[model samples]
Target: MISYLFGILSIKGKFEYFKMFLVLLSSLPNIDKRIKSIFQTIESVEDIVNIIIGGGAASLEKRASYSLEWLEQNGRCLDHIYSRLSDIPSAGRGAFSRRFIKKGEVVITSPLLAFQKSQLEEFYDKNNKIVPPPDFESRQVILNYCFSHPKSSLALFPLTHAMLINHASVRKGSNRHPNAKIRWATDHTETQKS
Candidate 1:
């Protein structure tokens, strides 16, 4: 049955559970790879991987929504199943980034932001140094540190999906409840003054 589901048969039906099931199935392969990579890049792989996954998930969500509708209309149960598989894993909208940064590590914000050579020399002179000693070793260490950490780090995959789902639910609720008042004090006096 599993093979058949994963293979040639395309089932099309409107059952919500079935839809969810399919989404889960299709997304399994990706979920496994993502989970495995989290450990492999333990030191500094979070930022780039999270960015890529987040972007991919965003694109996939749009495609899945459209595909889900098409599958419902065409009686393509297989497509529905695939959609469910993908949906289940990606239910959490912002999971990827959160998971990537879960590990306790420092991330460099900007590699290019550094002190100029002249500034370093001036500091050395002010400290009463006759000749500024070369700081190549320290500079190399700093470079290595920066390279080992990135700003946009994320937590592990399991944690990431949970976050994504929560974020998605919040976004969905906001969309549905547009009338929910957001408190804001309008500066009517300022407008009039202007």
Candidate 2:
């Protein structure tokens, strides 16, 4: 699935058909520039095979890294690492781990949606207060999901399933405990040294 856009089954007239498909895809306004360039530069079936093989290799490497990370940290690995329930008592859909994840282990890694100080102005009114809900619900929603400093407008929100994890209670006698944590993944060179 990495390279074969739409599973080329037959090679009888695939070269011309694939070329035409690439031409159409390249012309798409939303297509990535690098992919568009690749599509435009393809010369033959061998080129397509090379691209497909290269993409498959990269995909496999990425999966291998993720599996290795999970194996090192959790002692086991599963392709789909999480499960979501439609409802959990009073709580809405909750993110649950499909496998037993070790304490302090990374559940999922995703980039943060960092909002600049100036860009966050849209969430505030002229008086510099957070806009009220209903009318400005979208802005309020963004503020709710994002982590922002009171003195600064900078906000960082995880762009993945991590957001679905339920917040633990801080009150006494509550059964919930903060079992998970979030941290900025600064290093991608390799998994952290044991």
Q: Top model by TM-score, which number?
A: 2
Which lDDT tens digits does candidate 2 get at residues 1-194? 11222233242444554454444334433444533444455666655445343331222222223376675864422233443442336443345666777878877765445555354333333244554222233234445556678788676654344445665533335576676777766565454555
Predicted structure 1, TM vs. truth: 0.16
TM-score of every candidate = 0.16, 0.44
- Give lDDT per model, in order: 0.28, 0.46
Candidate 1: global Cα-lDDT? 0.28
**Residue ranges of candidate 1 with Cα displaced over 4 Å:** 1-37, 45-162, 167-194
In candidate 2, where is summed lDDT lowest over 10 consecutive residues? 55-64
TM-score of 2: 0.44
